[model samples]
Target chain A: MKDGPDIARIASLVGDPARANMLTALMTGAALTASELALEGGVTLPTASSHLAKLIEGGLLTVAAQGRHRYYGLAGPQVASMLEAIMGVAAGVGPKRARPGPREPAMREARVCYDHLAGEHAVKMMDTFLARDILVRDGQEIRLGPNSHSYFTAVGIDVEKLGPSRRPVCRDCLDWSVRRSHLAGQLGAAILDKILTEKWARREKDSRVITFSPKGRQAFERAFLEV
Target chain B: MKDGPDIARIASLVGDPARANMLTALMTGAALTASELALEGGVTLPTASSHLAKLIEGGLLTVAAQGRHRYYGLAGPQVASMLEAIMGVAAGVGPKRARPGPREPAMREARVCYDHLAGEHAVKMMDTFLARDILVRDGQEIRLGPNSHSYFTAVGIDVEKLGPSRRPVCRDCLDWSVRRSHLAGQLGAAILDKILTEKWARREKDSRVITFSPKGRQAFERAFLEV
Candidate 1:
């Protein structure tokens, strides 16, 4: 038998419904207080605290204490990707829910997957990049081409400055909603941050959706799509 | 909170250590009996039965009864992929084990991942396919091009007959051992099966390792590599 890493401990941490909900809520890339996560998970504060403690101890999440409150977020991008992978498998294998949430449409349109963009808009952006030869796949690795530097620079993201990090510059992460690949890694996070900084889109309060204004949509298309 | 499929329930099924060991043992893709799994998991037969029942009920596994013996295996490829993904994240996050198992090196060299091959050999095969243009990646999708039809057909896997399945013909599954993409789909399964049938390799009893003879290894490289 293959003796790999112990997966049961980490999985069991996410196995609880309330903890799963808390982790899902954190997929927005926002740090939330224990009470807030409790509300998000539909559990009491004590219960949420216990779960959060377990998650932090399990290394799937990290916490920071600021002033009177401690905030929790996913430990890093790996945790987020693992959660997304789980969601992908769960979508295909598990039974469908009877009633979809109100945020379903918005989430399917655009949402924050960890620190990057996901859903339809993200998929469209990825396709545009691929079609334009801004990104190329060398085997399983996704790398930015010579043209990508100038293109990202024109969009206010300094691709040069994103180098030297332990994190990859380009990564293809599976989108749970679209069942397609989206941009991830340092470049992915930078692009999403640039989009928000430009006011082209804004993340919905207390949710994962990224809502775009009409002007913002037009601007995004003119910049990314028209290429 | 978006109520998609319940991920926690399925994750919890994989959370228990005994169950996790059993599932890991099943990664060999062998239909093992309850007693075998119990021995592998270091659990009593009755306890293994309970865990197996829970896994079956949760749709993570399926069982078949032949005569007085009941055999259990992963429900489908999705389950196996989910487990691999979990192992990936766990490897990164979890605490390291004190002593590595004896089979660790061999498993990393060549092993069965569900119905497909994984580890170094599998990665090499995938790299060869990509280099030869037998398998072309169009964005996130891996497609067999014009050359692949003849190439696979010559290898005894009729590419034409692999159509019409809900499952994909070419898939890029991340190899947990290699941290690279390997072929996984109908074509992947077909190639692995061919190796076994040709006596090029045989799955080690009660293990995931696919032991290849010296002659078999030479033949495999000649067929897959020197293209």
Candidate 2:
């Protein structure tokens, strides 16, 4: 066998249509149960179990026990990034017969990417951060700006208490729909978590779309968009 | 058939072992004939032909005839970026039993990523550019710095006439092995083209490893690493 990282194995695991559906559903960043995933994937429960087993075995997903039920989520942000990149290519090269679904517009407006916000609203937040110097790019990496600590703390994301992790504090992920980028990594997740916790936005039921109330949207703008 | 981009079709194309090998081999940015790809993929010519046809149909690759031989290469930069991203996830989630190949060390030191240089040397060049303010990141986008035009022209890369293309002038590609970023996109390709044209390095036969002579290596450092 030619020696290198095994690309074929991972690609094969994701190549299955049912599994692809399941994985995409998990991109909402929510840990879902097998039955829910089966429904989303349009596969039987047994088939879903088998697919989930393979995904877990491949490390593309992680399983956790909540109460008497087990829930599945993407392994982490890296897997999400990989899947997003794949979608970018798929969108680029797929047959030109695409017909947008009813949910397409809402999804393109705002959605969850793994654990972070994505789409138009998310892009705006990232732009505001950069435009106001809350975050700056150094080389290819996004670094905390001079006032980032103060800015994030002001928004209830205590930078000092983010704890330690191998993941960067600030990173950017390409938005496939817009061909732009939104914030990702730990800081991005924190911002998203804050949004949901404060009831600024709520994830639409059984979907990745995030819906913000009029007041919440205004509050979000005041907090993240104000220079 | 489900909604959104057709990811399964594209992932399935990359799923097959032979096809995955073929795609990775083409990531060197050199167009190879069916026979050469067959050798790289460890498959028979007929099988390689079948795979090549499928890849072309899928838009992951493009073919052109040079003289009597048909050479196949990746369709474009987007395809290459997709493959690199896939490799990143593969390396992340693959089995932990990786044993280095004979050429692994050399490859990790320096390799070609599609039309650009990758690995350590490429990373250093990116760092130097940022440090010297020759390239500045403006909100996840790399734009020309004050001295960028002059610096690139001094190095024989005319910033004015790169031509109008949808491709970004500079983008950062994540390096899987190092968990760092390397320069990619149009400017990146130009630098690589210049390096090869100037005989600062030569591509290894039958591999992606770039071999820079002792003097060439020194010159590269002096030019890029100099303050």
Q: Interface RMSD in Å per candidate, to 1 decimal?
A: 2.1, 2.0
Candidate with best TM-score: 2
Q: Note the residue pairs that clash in candidate 1.
A: none
lDDT of 1 by residue, A8-94 (tens): 988998899999989887765567789999987898999999999999889999998989999898897667667876786676656
Interface CA root-mean-square deviation for model 2: 2.0
Ten residues in a row with the worst lDDT in model 1 chain A? A91-100
Error of 1 at A116 (Å): 7.6
lDDT of 2 by residue, A180-219 (tens): 7788888888899999999998998777789999999999
Per-prediction TM-score of chain B? Answer: 0.93, 0.92
DockQ of each: 0.49, 0.48
Q: Ten-residue segment with the worst summed lDDT in candidate 2 chain B? A: B1-10
lDDT of 2 at B70: 99
* Weakest 10 consecutive residues of candidate 1 chain B by summed lDDT: B91-100
